[model samples]
Target: MTTAVSLQNVSKSYGEFKAVDSLSLDITSGCVFGLLGPNGAGKTTTIRMIVNITVPDSGSVYIFGEPASAKLRSKIGYLPEERGLYKKMKVREQLLFLAGLKGVDSKDSANRIVTWAERLKIAEWLDKKTEELSKGMQQKIQFIAALLHEPRLLILDEPFSGLDPVNTSLLMEVIRELSKSGVTIILSTHVMEQVEKLCDEICLINKSRKVLAGRLRDVKSNYGIRKLLIAFDGGDSFLKDDSLSVERFPEHYELNISSVEQAQQILRKAINAGAIIRKFELLEPSLHEIFVNKVTGVDG
Candidate 1:
C-alpha cells in the first residue's frame, strides 16, 4: 500500500499556457498506473515533472516518498514518446551507454542486455546500427534500454506506438511480468484498450487538471451497469427502438439501457420482432467510454 510516485499540487506553465494546473496524483507501488488524457491534456507535462526532465513551477514530485533527484533517477527508467538513441551506434553500444548513465556496471549491464534482447527477440539485431532497424525494432530496443538497469520504477509514454501486433504482445507480456515482480509502472498512452488491460489504477487529466483518479473497478462500477451486449440473428428491426442508444458490431449490438426494466423490454421487443437472440448480458462502462464522457461531456 506504499506510494511509489506522488505529485502534490504540481503545476507547470509555458508563458500564457498552463500545461498542468495544480495536478496531484499518487501512484501505488508495485502496480501499473495509467495516466490518461486526450491530446494536449498535460499528460506529457506531468510525466516530465515526474522524471525531472522539466522542473515544476510549483508544488513537488516525490519518488518513493523522497524528492526527485539525479541519483534517484538511476532507479527510475523513463521511455519518452520520442525515441532517442545514437543512429550510428550499434544496438549493444547504445544500450551500454544508456545503462552506464544509470550507474549499471559493465558486467551486470551486459548480462541484462543479453537477457532482455533475447527475450524481446532482438538479439539478432544487436550488431546492427540503430538506423538499420525498422521502427518497431527500434521500439523494442528502447524498451530494453529502459529496463537495462533493472529499474524499480518504469515510466513509458506511448510504448506501443508504431509496434505491430506481434511485437506489441511481446512487450505486453514483459510488462505484465515486470508488474508481477513488484516493479511500479506509470503508463501514459492514448490507447484506452491497453490501459483497461494493464492498469490497476488510473488518473485521468483534462486541460491540465485531474478529472478522475481511483481503482479502475470502482471507477467503472460507479458509472453503473448500463451497457448491454446482445447478439441476434435474422431481423434488424428491433434496433429501431428510439429509447436505446446503440452501437453496432458484426456479431452483436451494444445498447444503452436506462434500467433493468428497460433491458427486459429490449429483449421482449427483439423476440417479438422475429430476431433470434443468441446472447444477452449487462456490462460495465469501458474506460474509453468513461474517458469520452469525462473529457468531452458526451454520454459514455
Candidate 2:
C-alpha cells in the first residue's frame, strides 16, 4: 500500500517544553485520515513540521516517499486554524496569487477558480474584495484557494469552523469529492462526529503522544463496551438480570451486556417477562466514548 505521509519518531520542542513526542504514524494514499486531539495537544506543531513551516527538533517525516522538501511542499494544500488572506485583494486575485506561488498557470488557475466558485454558488462574489464577504463566503473562497493548485494532499485544521450547518454540509460534500478523486486528506479537528462519519483511519494524540491509531471501525471495537439500549412496556424489574447492568433513561433503559450472546438472552428474558418492546439497538461506542476512555486512562 502506498503511503501519503509517514512520521518516524517525530518530535519537536521549544526550549524545555516538548510539544510533539516521538510520534510514529502513517496516512495511506487516497484516504481521509483524521488527526484528533484536544487543544494544546501538539496537533498544530505536527502539521507545521509536515508542511515544513518549522524544523523538527528530532526525527524525520516522509511525504510521498521522499523527505518533506521544498518540492513536496507544493503538493500539499494547508488550511491552517488561523486563517490568512489579504483583506484588500479581490477573491479571484488572492486565489490567483496563491496559485501562482504554487507554480500554477494563470489561465488554468482561473479556470479552476471559476469552476469551483460556480459549483459552490459563489460566482457572483469573484469580483468582490475578500473583506466584503461574510465569514461563510470567505471560508468558501479560502477553501477554493486551497484546492486551486490541485494539491495531492490537503491538510485542513478545523475545516468546519465558523460555518452554519448548511455550509458545513456543503464543505463536507466538497471534501468527500476531493478524496474520491484521489486526494489524500489529513483532517484535524475536535469534532468527533465528523471524524466518525468521514475518516477511514484515525490517529488520536494526547499530550504530544499517540494514544490510539488504527482503522476507525477496528479502533471503536477495540475500545468499545458491549451494550444494548432497549425500550419496552414493562416494569423496571424486567431488566433485572445477573448478566447485565442497567441504566435508565427517560424513554428507555440501557443494558450493559457482557457479551453479544447476553444481549440476545436479555431480549428473550424481556419478551418472556411480558414486555412490549418499542426500540432495541445494539450499542456501539461512539468516537466520543472511545476518546474519553483513552484520554482519561480508564481502560477498566
24-71 in candidate 2: lDDT tens per residue?
999999999999998899999999999989988889999999998888
Q: What is the lDDT of candidate 2?
A: 0.89
Alpha-carbon lDDT, every model: 0.91, 0.89
lDDT of 1 by residue, 81-196 (tens): 88778899999999999999899998899999999999999899999999999989998999999998888999999999999999888899999999999999999998999999
- After superposition, candidate 1 runs with Cα above 4 Å error: 231-241, 247-252, 265-276
TM-score of each candidate structure, all chains considered together: 0.91, 0.93
Find the 10 residues in a row with the least total lDDT in model 1. 236-245
Model 2 collision count = 0
Pairs of residues clashing in candidate 1 = none
Q: Scored by Cα lDDT, where does model 1 land?
A: 0.91
